[model samples]
Target: MERSETTATTRLSTWRQVKRMKLLYLLLLLPVVQLFIFQYIPMYGVLIAFKDFKVARGIWDSPWNNFEHFRTLFSDFIFLRALRNTLIISGLKLVFGFLAPIVFALLLNEIRHVRFKKITQSISYLPHFMSWVIAASMLVEIVSPQRGIVNYVITLFGGDPVHFLASKTYFVPMLIISDIWKEMGWAAIIYIASMASISPELYEASDVDGANRLQKMVHITIPAIMPVVVILFLLRLGNILEGGFDQILNLYNPLVYEVGDIIDTYVYRVGLVEYKFDYSAAVGLFKNVVGVVLLVTANLFVRKVSDHGAW
Candidate 1:
């Protein structure tokens, strides 16, 4: 009798499991359908990179070029410059941009006045919604040698007006600063959310132990949010090759190209404008390969060192 009851119970559980799975599939049917239609369907076009990609002969009939495109891309002069500039810009942004948001989040968390904190956050976050083109125009206006607010401030302090945007030496710094200004508050939103999850009891306990605000922040708050920071930092390592293309493209001029040109702009100018599709595809493929390798390596390293990883 006991064995018969156990078998009947098992059969009932299996039926319930099948019913739940069917319900889940019904709920997910639309999103899965959309992903297949839009995302997976487009991947078939990547074959163009492997072909000579003649317009007359569709992707199916285009002759295979094998590695010829890659060879030409590697030998191109501007490709090297673009690669170097991309690395420099991305490295700077990764280091400085990453830290700025965390610092801002911490500072905002310390604010005792709710209204002041909200006002400051709102003001800082407003710039993030502005388009890159509009932001670039604002940057040009502010850094213009004559009649700009920055230059006017310098003159008021008895200093000569500096043409910040015109000089290549200052262009990278300007990009970093402007990007930080636009993104820091928006980026801090995640860190702030992470910080909020930390138990209030931890702060109270530290206070009872004679810990000051700064000490509590350093010892309690920072440690609490560190896992989120580590995860974000690891994720960022995957996209180091992208290098804020739209912002750089909008803000840069021919004079600043040597220092500010990156892979996306390079690909745009050469592939779309100049119509060297094969070469541009090769360069883009190279960047994607590096990004994939970095993501995998970083995830593995994080897992080994901290036991926290993307996977």
Candidate 2:
């Protein structure tokens, strides 16, 4: 009888807690439902990757293609080049893009004037809201050899104007710079929020210790936000195989394909353009598998080293 009463009390307590948080839970339900409908449900379509998918037969009725598509992808001459381009571009973005945001956050944190800082941050973040198509078109105009602003400046300086977008040698760097410009400000917002959460008492204490501005930044500000940095970096590692598909597709041309084409663009060209869905699916599945493995590895490393992980 006593045990039964205890169980009943526990259930009542749980019910009360849920009742207290009911509105918040209700608000979360819409996104949860949408995720189920859009994100989770679409995962079922991934089965087509393992099959010789046909429109008439549909995903369910398609025959299993085994590993034939993967074999074909591996044997393709362009496969290595696509893989190399994807890795190189993603790697550079990870290194430069990752650092750019952190540096921007740090610099913004040091700004003393409120109005100026707000204006600077607002202007910097504006580009992030622009569609990739619009941004890419703007970039093309700026980099055009004939009349683009970048080439115009080069010519003004007595140097020959370079074809930035068309040149294989310049494409990767151009992509990296454009990506940094678009995303650094947006990414820095996270770091800035993390910085805000840092206790002002720590800065006061550092000031009392006669620590200079740089010293305080290095000791207090950075350490306070290090966890946020670690988590974001780990997340980036998970998607190391993906080089911004929309941005790349909009920016790159066939002339720069050797240096600029990534896995996503290659998949699009092969699947939709060439009607090689099986081959593209195989490539996509490979990327997804690698991403999952990398995410798990990064999570484990974070847990072991810092006692914090994605989970």
lDDT for every model?
0.89, 0.90
Off by over 4 Å in 2: 1-8
TM-score of 1: 0.90
Over all chains combined, what TM-score does candidate 2 have? 0.95
Each prediction's RMSD over C-alphas, in Å, is: 3.3, 1.7
C-alpha positional error of residue 157 in candidate 2 after TM-score superposition, expressed in Å: 2.1
147: Cα error in model 1, Å? 2.1
Error of 1 at 165 (Å): 1.9
Clashing pairs in 2: none
**Cα error, candidate 2, residue 79 (Å):** 2.6
At residue 223, candidate 2 shows an lDDT of 84
Give a tens-digit lDDT track for model 2, residues 100-146: 99999999999999999999999899999999999999999998989
Q: Pick the candidate with the highest TM-score.
A: 2
